[model samples]
Target: MKYAALTGISPSVIAELKTGKARTLELSSAHNIITLTETAPGECLFITSVNEEDLAPGDAGIMVDLLVLNISMKRVEVTSSFAFEERERMSARIKVQFRGTTIARDVEGRKWGDPTKVEIIRAACYRAG
Candidate 1:
């Protein structure tokens, strides 16, 4: 599974050629993984293989969420052994804050019987400005 974080100056700000909300985000500091430079605008960074032995869980599954601040520093954190019942799916709550204003959305995924086939869920950007 591949995980990624996408960041870029909002198109409107970029068009104006101003740092109205421009900032550099470090993927390693946030996700503890190498940064992926892709063509996508909204996706700026990512971490993968959270299920690997090096970072595997013992009992309960994990919860992934992105903390996006007004300054454009987006952080991805994982909480292990999060609450979940058998046959229940996993979900991520993405929160975005800009200039002290906040908005949130949820990303949901299911646990496949086969671990190898587990799908990679994306915590997309709900607001770019």
Candidate 2:
């Protein structure tokens, strides 16, 4: 699916946008907005939102890079004494969520603190196998 990025948007507003119930939006920030009127063949649309206010000066850019990296990586890993597992052959369209315990830098390409935890949420994928 093609990504349509929306930052500093509330979840409710996102839902409204997905349902085609919202024709307009009132943004409190000065960020730029891009609207898509149509998509080409074999293309799909998906909305992804991030809150710029919640991020540090350049952390938002890192988040965007992480997202691209996560999807392109196309694999999952979880390690623990009780469980250690990895998987490939998953859908190329799935999204992975990661949580960083701390950030080391206040600018672009910020480094994640030690002991960052990765949590993968189960969602619809292109293939279950």
Candidate 3:
């Protein structure tokens, strides 16, 4: 099994996780920390981790990075007019990259004419094995 490691924490934490500047940490460290936000119940906490390792053929000991998390989004809808006019549904996709590696991806659908917002609810990271 793999574990999540804590690298750093933000000093100026925000009521909402999305509102504050992200803190950076070294990927070689190991620790776990929980971050809280001002969102609703079941929608306010976030987590992340990091680890170090060596996988390069010659390097012998290189640190790879990994990140994981869950994101939330506000509901969206398409207006009848827009749907009829464009004949397409509104959609969004998220892509995550770590040390030049694609780790995870997700897509969500949105209404043609509705306001939409998303939250990265959870995330974790570690050195690639």
lDDT of each: 0.28, 0.30, 0.23
> Each model's TM-score, in the order given?
0.20, 0.27, 0.16
Model 1, range 1-129, lDDT digits (tens) per residue? 343322222344223323233333332222222122211334322223233233322212212233442223334454559754334222222332222211112111222221121223333447677
With a 3 Å backbone cut-off (N, CA, C), the pairs that clash in candidate 2 are none
Model 3 lDDT tens row, 1-129: 111222232322212223332323322111121211112222212222212121111211111232233333334455685463323322212121222111212211133222112222123457787
Off by over 4 Å in 2: 1-4, 33-49, 53-129
* Higher-scoring candidate on TM-score, 1 or 2: 2
lDDT of 2 at 77: 84
lDDT of 2 at 7: 44
Model 2 scores worst on lDDT over the 10 consecutive residues at 62-71
Best by lDDT: 2
Better of 1 and 3 by TM-score: 1
Per-residue error for 33 in candidate 2, Å, reads 5.3
* Model 3 per-residue lDDT at 5: 20
Better of 1 and 3 by lDDT: 1
Model 3 residue 74 distance off true place after TM-score fit, in angstroms: 1.7
